[model samples]
Target: MFSPTSFDSRRRTLVSWLLPVALAGACSLAWGQSASDWPTKSVRLISPYPTGGAPDAMARVLADKLSKKWGKPVVVDNRPGGNGFIAIDAFKRGAKDGHDLIQLDSVHLAAYPYMFKKLPYDPAKDFQVIAPIFKSFMYFVVPTNSKYQTIGDVIADAKANPGKLDYGSWSIGNPVHLGMEELAQIAGLKLQHVLFKETTQLYTSVANGDLPFTMGTAGTAGPLIKAGKLRPIAVAAPYRLPAFPDVPTVAESGGPKAPYEVSGWNVVAGPKELNAAIREKIRADVAEAMAGADVKERFINFGYESLALDRKQLADFITSESARHENIIRRAKIELD
Candidate 1:
């Protein structure tokens, strides 16, 4: 039989061991609860474009609204260049705790994978889709004073003078170039692609009568169209935009009714492995912010169609867009240098 003192000593030792385990459990629970209550500090929104571009502008607007709504400073960081790989790399290195978010676009997430032989990041594995902010219509525009009134007229001219007619875009592999190529394939007309280094130059060339026309996002073309320097011939969207009710859609513009839709989409994403609770919180806040009256008005002013899709919806849309762009790129034989 064991002595009473010995039994008491064993009990004490057992208690000593169990106390630490209980304390550890408590600490873990506290930590998890704290994490559940996220946005304890400022949130960083990374924009992969220059300061004046549409993506950057959208990021600023969202950051302002989110900052006010959450009572936390949401900073917009512009890491422009390197085809958005620079900003994406910065985002990957950020905290996985959901304090860092990236404003990603369809080109970087959907089209770049197929356009380039090897992309720097993996769309499926590197990022988690939080929510979609907005969708911008892609417009085919010409000088307001030009004689060609419709897409058919442009196609007729291109066919009549195959290599003489030129259309400009910001760069190769951009949606403008790819969309024009897709349009050319459908219309059975070849065009000389005039590449510009920036949208300002591209639009200026068109506005100055140096180039006949170009394709651009509504955000970039809205002010120009409103100012009467650019005339929208057709919008490559599913339906007519509310902002531009008079403009015809590609389907309505005498083009092949096949889905020739291309638009600039803005989505919020974080590095892979973000906590589910934090992700849901941010998504909910952003969706709510987007639905607010001020945000909606601003989106309309920028000619963006507000989209407040949840994670599953955003994932599905991204997947479909990826497949759609893959087919379009393959058919157009578009490869980046």
Candidate 2:
């Protein structure tokens, strides 16, 4: 007599044994050609950020390095705008064969679904997240002479004078904007949201004290800080930045437990139907490019931490990061229409 419990256990045991075999077969089937046969033509690297920015610079570096490695032209196509939708749309339409790849910010893959009422492309279905290139931490910056000296001071002032304080960023729902929104909720601040059309004017406004606060990466703000034009009120990170050891994290800088500690990250991915083998090859190539001394130096200058995670590590990292953003969106009560 076969008990129901025994039958279910037997089924579970069978699946556990067959799952790996099936996965291996699928991988082999997708890996139809040798590495030399792959990348048979020129590759297009689509970028969401405009030219002359950190993302564009990094994309070009990887393109040049990969082009040399593959013996083909690797071109960077800049389609920056619409909160990265422009480039993502181009990638979906351009590369059915998986040769064309796009650089994506983790925020786009994780936060946009909850930030907007409708997204044009489904993050999980429209692309395959090959691997992460690097991560960047944000800093809470104020004018050098501002009365506010710490992140806690800014929050208290906002509370003391509700809706009187304002912060600036280039776009809506970007990590810069969303991080501030989350911070306000955590610190119970009533502040005004300010938008700018370009980063140049935005940082300049902060330098001139037109805005009370803004978030900037080290590459973006470090020069100004070193020039004695801007002061870092606090860093929105888990630990103190090694470059600026004198500065403190949000909590260390006297703010309430912050909701904006997760650093921003960028990834290289391709069309969802990209061959498993090809995807794996691209991931490996990109990792090697990142490991070069010159590549690391450029990223350092841009205030990025190179991740270069292996396949298993990459999968686990993306999954954990997505879950963190989902929790933040839910807690912040952020829903766009």
Candidate 3:
């Protein structure tokens, strides 16, 4: 046992095991440091919406705040069109160090999976959804001088004259269309859907009495509503919004008694392999950024309600929203190419 050759061989065996462990510990330490010093360079916040829209405004405000916080440039790269695929694909191919993030809406995360037969991106695989930035409720908008006074009037008319009452939205599977269809299904009434190319055309048609009604947001239909061209019969929210205190909720207006609500929201998402520490840091920083007076004012101007949900709560919200969209899509037989 005291032989020099035997002692040398034992020492060599111990060195092999210790070397790997030493290297692993060093790597872990370096990775931790890298995470702590995240955004080692400039960060890019990608947006699917074009400039001047609410989503772009949101991205820009966050970029400004985060840039100041990290002492590095945080630029918003707008890659609008292709139903948000352009921005998503760009993000997927962009920096792998988590310096690039994407802003996604409820349609991309909740409705599209069921609407599209083969989606370009996988929600569960491609994204690490962080948290919701804001949510805005849609109102049941009608012409001001119309015969209907409340949502119940519309429902009763639909029941009395099945398939006569119709609604409009910009697209087939948008929240407005889906929510209205869900309401019709719940109340056992037949209603028709009218499609428009954009919100202006949709709401204008409603104002002109060409379209009976359509779901609209304050930001989109506020001008007409304020001009006394369109009337908001009810808002699809659990409770009344502070800005519109007089408006009743969908339930209060004799909608489904089973608690129905329709809203559109935006959330920031990162690459699937984003580091955990950096992710948490970004979430916390975003929350702080949103709490600022400037961001709050922007939200108010956009008619958006700030959502301060944690990661788990956001995940659950997405799941529930996806399920709700699936139910309506299946019932309404809506499938897009």
Candidate 4:
């Protein structure tokens, strides 16, 4: 017969060991079930822009297709304003089960971190990159009848006039604003920045000759250029855009070829704590969705190039872009006011 104290100690040891084994088995089972039963309910995709913006349009299209593919409802929640902070806040506070997705852009991911001294979220720790949906080629546009016919001409004029030449963008701290500043920095010139509250107003001002020129994504400027209201002087991309092959790239148009390309991008991201398996699944699904015929056609029509990079590649791109934009922000002295 065992002593009473020895018997109690043996029982406690056995219970502790058994409890851990049981818990591990239960957790494994739950993870497997979650992976298998994902999309049993609706998935919410949050767009940081207003309902009519390009990001909103892309999210809606993707949500519809994803809904059909997964056999569940896919809803797009538009929470515009606050420089994308509003949407990001909502996403951070939402469920961490991979049921909620957020659409992010370069400003939110790359520029904001450097522009603001005190950011509310950390890009590396607060969110994970799911997939890169699309990348739009940026173009330097001026009035169709403006004196500047090429990128070289703009650079020359800026060198001569210094701060007299002014460019307009939709807002401060946007890619358009930063890209132009980068161009000026590279070309060794100076120019004034004019901020507009609305995109339509910005383009209209450019078309009507209120401003000399502006940098804009091809998707927004394509229609205007095709309609003969604006002229594409140069494409600020790694290579010439297929849609505007006749137009020369920044390198080809006699601008400094120091890899000064910038564009508006759409990406899928989730809360930082999302399960790895769920995150990968969403990333794969987005890649497939972007490759679909309808999705490809829509992107082509809008003058956007499909990126469709996997999780690792997307993460690498974001990291590199963050570094690149941080340097630009520091050199340009851009602030979020």
Candidate 2 TM-score, true structure as reference: 0.86
TM values, all candidates: 0.86, 0.86, 0.87, 0.88
What's the number of clashes in each of the models?
Answer: 0, 0, 0, 0
Report how far off residue 279 is in candidate 4 (Å): 1.1
lDDT of each: 0.76, 0.76, 0.78, 0.77
What local lDDT does model 2 show for residue 303? 73
* Winning candidate number (TM-score): 4
> Candidate 3 residues 36-145, lDDT tens each?
68888899989988887677888888899999999889999999888888999999898756789989888987778677767798764577776568898888989998
Alpha-carbon error at 116 in model 1, in Å? 1.3
TM-score of 4: 0.88
Q: Which tens-of-lDDT digit does each residue in 1-337 have in candidate 2?
A: 2233533443343333223222322332253555558888899999998998887888899999999999999999999888899998998888656578999987676677556666787764577677678888888889889998998788888889988998998876677877877777677877677889987777888989999889998877777888888899888887777657788999898886644584788888777666766766787788899999998888768878888777656665665565566555666666665
Pairs with steric clashes in candidate 2: none
Candidate 4 per-residue lDDT, tens place, 173-228, comes to: 88888888888888888999998888888998999999999988766877788899
Better of 1 and 4 by lDDT: 4
lDDT, candidate 3, at 39: 87
Task: Give the best candidate by lDDT.
Answer: 3
